[model samples]
Target chain A: MASLPPKHRLQSSAADSAATGQHEHHRPRGLMRWVLTTNHKEIGTLYLIFSLTMFLIGGVFALVVRAELFQPGLQLVQPEFFNQMTTMHGLIMVFGAVMPAFVGLANWMVPLQIGAPDMALPRLNNFSFWLLPIAFTLMLSTLFMPGGAPNFGWTFYAPLSTTYAPPSTTFFILSLHIAGISSILGAINIIATILNLRAPGMRMMDMTLFVWTWLITAFLLIAVMPVLAGVVTMMLMDINFGTSFFNAGGGGDPVLFQHLFWFFGHPEVYIMILPAFGIVSVIIPTFARKRLFGYASMVYATASIAILSFLVWAHHMFVVGLPLVAELFFMYSTMLIAVPTGVKVFNWITTLFRGSISFEPAMLFAIAFVVLFTIGGFSGLMLAISPADFQYHDTYFVVAHFHYVLVPGAVFSIMAAVYYWLPKWTGHYPHLRLSQWHFWLSVIGVNLTFFPMHFSGLAGMPRRIPDYSLQFADFNMVSSIGAFMFGLSQLLFVVIVIMCVRGGKTAPAKAWDGAEDLEWTVPSPAPLHTFEHPPQYRPVEH
Target chain B: MVNVVEDRRPQVRRTVIKTLVVLAGMCVFAFALVPLYDVFCQVTGLNGKTASSAQSLVHQEVDDERTVTMQFVTRGAAGLPWRLEVEERQIRVHPGQSAEVHFTFRNLGERSLVARAVPSVTPSPASLHLRKLVCFCFENQRLAAGESFTAPLVFQLTRDLPPEIKAVTLVYTLYPQENDTVTAAMPDDGKHIDAVATRRWADRSSGGET
Candidate 1:
């Protein structure tokens, strides 16, 4: 119906799926297929499902933490257990929920968007995806261990995490090692796929921002995940090997541990959010029916942000008694980051200006991400001031600032990506009424949970504590209620996803009006192998 | 299709190898942070690990015009059974002049115990210029049951101490050690784990900040 090459490719892909399905039917069925299958789509589905499950698990831990903080006294859990909840919540959310979800999205979309048949190394993809559950299992099992799970907070600052840590700290480190291996391997696979598999005519610049951002994100993952592995390994040595890497009495400084953790930590945050920038870039333009404004600038801005991420790691350590010169240097470098971040915000807004804007669920989430993420950005700038950081560091304000970025920024963007692509994945249009409800409830719940934290933090409530002074009572109660509301509202998201996947009105190949990517060129529920031959890329006339 | 897939395999292998190399390098770099952090601190004196020998304590003329109140504070960690107290609560000393302070420690516990006193000076900027000639914190102290001992600390604040600082506090927290060694909880947040060292400074002209 279209042109010769695409038509031929589609026919062959359909035949390919049918024949493969027949062969798959003859092979060991059920879980064996998932365990051994090299199909990108199936593996992507596994990753997405796994991340969703982890999301719920991490959410429960968060609720437990909020519940205990509901009152001044310890209400639901002991102090140590509360610490475990806070620690595990941070670990599971960052590693299990956010990182894997981004990787899952990359697994599904990177090859399709780039006109590749599958991931560059399909078997490696399966290995990476499977390693996650094992790592998390080992980590979660530590909760039941004799000494309990890691309770030193997720940042796991030294002296706290090293000498005085629980016995389960070794398990936590090993689990992180496993997880880091998965991330590094996953990053390698993504880099290979994006570099090697692009269609014949598609220029690097012409690729979707999602793919571009991922290419950058993959590099970041490769660069920093090993640093995480290395740092945790050093922590391991310090714990058991009689190494005084962070022991002051052994002539090692504790502040050195902060330096290493934040070096990995700062880049890790960008790894979660850069892909978010790419996703928002794609969705905002599509729903606005406008060519993304200043596409070149957007790409440069992302690169700048990545480059600047390394320079700002020391900013997190201002209160650790850095020299005055070092403090001033870190402060200026941190504030300079606001310049490139402003460039990105300006570009997104410019893309939305005077266009045929629509209010789909995806757009609503994207819009909210822009607004709320900026609020987080403003708070971050406020924290960058060295003197001010002394007041805000380790406080609820820090908690609120990160949540605003993560829950509303990174987590919200993932929801946006899912809603935007669900029709294509399921071959069924999403139930709009349900999705809208999910979006509104999520936006409301996110704000309610994180907003009051700013005030509490400002009023001098330190984080990672089981109980706060009575002064923080009212705000904690409101935050806990909001957290529960947010947790419950996500069930609606599950319902929406399940309902769409099961059956609904069929969606056409072009699910949305403004869709013009290579992915949309294929039929809905893209055949097992969508692009056996590279799809032709023709520039659209402006 | 078969040809294309086969041809790209080596390229994929190459990128994968390259990425693995980067990953390995980063891992090595991470472990490198240990010595790197040490060198950084040594160069900058940022971590407050002062090297008295490295500093050339030239005799800059004493500031006769201004006198700063030097205070000694002693705190016992929660688990510590030793009662530690400073001999002099406060003293007035001019910049560049050496001062000696005494602290008394008594083993209140029934058993003989090993205690280590870790010293910290604040405001921290002044700690950089405040050099110690001899300190009891440099060694471990063992006290028999009911035994009491007094240890002396001799230090001089260099003339480089900022004019704004009219006072300085030197705190020594006595921590009970195990197996003849102090625990690793010496730096940052000493209050939580074992003993604590908190030095408070209040300029006479300016009100107490804390």
Candidate 2:
């Protein structure tokens, strides 16, 4: 491959694309380009920026919620609006922020890593990216609707969500349907891209952990997003038409809604986090200057986690009066998930074992992800025990568990990925001093915000409540303050990305010395068209 | 380059379409869960919604010495504008014998309201053992403005009810049906038959209790 000469190879590939007249790089200039272009990179940029905007909007909702909960009394918003705040915050953060952020990363990274020219279905990619804003706009518009937004919580358990829902509930369901459609289409596009568009030499097993992880994540998305659409459609029928699917008088069972919801909801959790596993796998090894330990086992572990995710949704409903056998089955399956998860944690640690480690900003975030995500895993295990879950379910401890997993587990990996790939995307190294400051403040602020939740939850504080007894006031105050600090710190991340994108210090093609992937082989600030002809592959020994 | 990708287009199209078809099928399957849930409940008697009116009565020996404390709880759905209170909040019932409790529902809203009550049994396993011989939940009640009516819930605890469950709570939630005037706009099918069948199933499931 080295004998072919880089200049000649590039010339031939460029000639090949130009002769076809398909690589005509002239595009519609200005906003029209974004609105109409089918380029994967442009669409990925749109997905990412859109998610970041949602994150900020959702963050505002969270801050309003925290401000109200700062003291025992409702000092800011009314209780009803406060309910709306919490509901919108959970919905936006889960669907609009975290999930899309991961998908955005997949869109940018998977094609580059796999040595493909672009996503398999570039047009569908644009469609997926565009649906998000329309869906989210419709969802956010509900806040101004006659009865305000959904106050039944994001889970939207039935009877409450069905018969008592606001008139806007129909719109909310429609918006969810649109968003679900976006996700399903996005998943299909990813699956097609991964299966059919890989470079000739890159076998399934030869791909990086990120590519493998996305393949599985896309499959999970395809499998479950439709189920969510299904459940919401039933909610629509119950609210508008006369259907007792979840009505007891109409011979419909309320618990059946929960069953159907969690069946989708459980795997939904993994859909958000499995990609984090992939991002961490890439970052930790690069920083550690070592090949990822237990590479095959890591793949197997990811697959097992995905398979087990389907079995463990009922762990969320232990307090709903499940029979002993059902409880035990869900309990045992939930605990079994811990095994593959443990394998992943152990693999990351082993990869870091006394290797030539360097503490860059991305590495810092990746390391934090490992330590904090494990704490989350431990709390998850505690909740998995059916007997203990009876005490923990719906409590702030449950709140603490998920936030620890999501904030540090998923969100941190996203930060690390941005930092890790910023140079390649922007052709400039990020401002290092400010980057470090952003990372530390975020870590501290996150702990401050969520750590006290454990104590309050164990002391009998239920979640989704605006007011609490005087005993919880002090902890709530601490949590609220921490939340404000954390929320403000994200502004620094925005500043850093802006400063970097404006050209800080020019970076080379291979941004990091130890980084060894197809992405690094391309020039910094990757061109609009990449890998038009698949790049030749060279096998590396561990 | 165009030919290379174009050559593979049909296969990719097939795969994409197949994936989409699977997604649509899954959505349909989700709707299917409604009927599936009903069938599952009927089979296991899991949700206290076993509406099969074809059961032959099994008269087991009455356990006169055994009594279970049954609590009745009532709640009004939002916008229902109804005040609901159980005439008797708690009752002691003997196994294999029927019991009746009355609930007073007063529609405070200044309009004719059609409301239906839905019931749930707690300690869920107990659902299989508690049989409803006559319950207000069997049909929708249409109440005029300011109308107050006392509806009765007649039920029994079977002798086969596990001895471990000494207490069971039955909660009835009142939801105002979509305004009866709105039904005229919808295509009229014989939905009346479902209500009738539901009542008949309730009757046969607990036939001899009264």
Candidate 3:
């Protein structure tokens, strides 16, 4: 594979001497670079901005939903429109918001962290990011179609999605197919880059936790995204060809849909959160001014969680009806997850115990994730109880549980990561007061919005309903108010990010007193092309 | 040179072991795929046995249009209390045609409710069938109280319903009423029908509860 001969290298060196510093001037300039470029960093920036825009759009949809549910009796939108809100909100946040945000972070950070010139497959990376806008365009365009957007919820289960689905479902499925392809290609690129392009002497164990988690997450993506593609394809076939893969008359079972979905679905959940674990793992240590506690255990625990994720998916289906023995098996396997998860939490707390700590916005979000992710985990355990799930399944309880995981768990970590790395990316610190307000308001608003859902769910309020009875009125009202506040608080984050980007007080190479990482070893406002040569690896001493 | 050769030998051995282990793992993984898939199906109810049947009820015709008061009884899943209401409260259908009815259900419990409608015919062995056109309970119904919306069901006398079947009765089961108070008020007697039961039956089936 080493195609360049020694003579060619020598001649190139002679040519390089002739134009030593002129290379920078010759770099690609203007809009042509952005539109028809293969630069990893530029594509990464585009992905981040695009994801942020989608996040706001999805947040608006959520605000609409919360507004209607605020006082109960259809104040903001009709039932059909409300259903569209829920459906589109879920689709956008998952595919457009969270996943893209993580990919953006990966694109920006992975090459620099790994001491590579750029992503191994730069063209594929550009293709992945560009596919997103096209996919989302198709998805959003469905809202204007006849009979409105998909109202059967994001899961798009059988029969409802097949027989009763709107004309827009075809477009929805095609859009998701494009998105899935993008995800798969992105995952493959990440894997190949990590495995094949590491700087000489940069071993697997020497890599940062974020890189490792993403490597595994990429594997999970390759393994299961195809399954998602398979299921959705079957859905399309069922819709078009009159196949019964999910229909009874066609000698197929509808519950099979749930099984196949959760297979991909469970791993998909981990895909969203494992990067969160990596993010927290990085941020917690930086704030604590100490090497991570139980580093090996953290790695093993993450691997254990990924493996356990497959076994425990049936917990989602306990109410769908299964044999008692199978139920017990799934229940126990699901509960066992709490053990490894507990290990991660304990390690984080121990890292924080005696170390000098400062509550920067990043640290604030990290600590909040520790507390709230546990809440989500506890609710998951509750749902794991097969008999207990008979009550909680598909109710507001389940809704509250996942929101706890996703919002406080995944979304907060993304915020923390942004705040933590903002200095490095921008060469300046973000506005402190605004960042603090963003943190506090998000903390309060998120809890207010999701907390009452537990009560309403326990009160027998089902999820995905356009409207509810008078009894659930108060909690829904509080939640809706909380949701609006939460939505508005995110705008503060956007402002903080924008202000930091436009330029703020210049930062030192080492931005935080406690921060210690190879990334900080480089100059702030990282060079367009970074670490052309690998840095020496030195283990941190406790 | 001798020392470097010795180091290379161990590296080679380690690489061989790693490769063998990975190959073994791959084989195991490939072997497990089918069983794992089957288990996945069974657990997720992908087998279709656990799902509600879409088979319509055999339709029956009644010779008379006399106002026959058909009673509905409902019991919800445990720990979920529901209240149901119909917009018109009743419907009149011709001997050969169908009628559409709308019923709304509310969750009065402090917790979220997961309820499904199990449509049963009142006269056993009668050929009368009910076809749901639009229903909230088709998959499952999640209702937040102070939150209520109507679900519509379309049904016709399948033309095969026994002529002897004059009126059809639909029963809904709302299990696990959220509060003990709600459950205690109604008890599990064959006769007594409460708000939760009335709501579930109305929302689930097309009949008035007395």
Best by DockQ: 2
User: Compared with the true structure, what per-residue lDDT tens digits does model 3 show for residues A351-429?
Assistant: 9999888899999999999999999999988998888999888899999999999999999998998998888777788
Better of 1 and 3 by lDDT: 1
lDDT winner? 2
Docking class of 3: incorrect
Error of 2 at A512 (Å): 0.9
The TM-score that candidate 2 achieves is 0.89
Model 1, docking class? acceptable
Assess each model's interface with DockQ, reporting 2 decimals per model. Answer: 0.39, 0.43, 0.03
TM-score of chain B of each: 0.74, 0.73, 0.47
- On TM-score, the leading prediction is 2
Question: Candidate 2: which pairs clash?
Answer: none
Task: Estimate how well candidate 1 is docked, as a DockQ score.
Answer: 0.39
Regarding DockQ, does 1 or 2 come out ahead?
A: 2
Tens digit per residue, CA lDDT, model 2, B14-87: 88988888887877887787778777766776665432221223356768899899998888887788888897
Query: Which of the two candidates, 2 or 3, achieves a greater DockQ against the reference?
Result: 2
Residue B43 displacement (Å), model 3: 15
* Deviation (Å) of A79 in candidate 2: 1.3
How close is every model to the real structure, measured as TM-score?
0.89, 0.89, 0.73
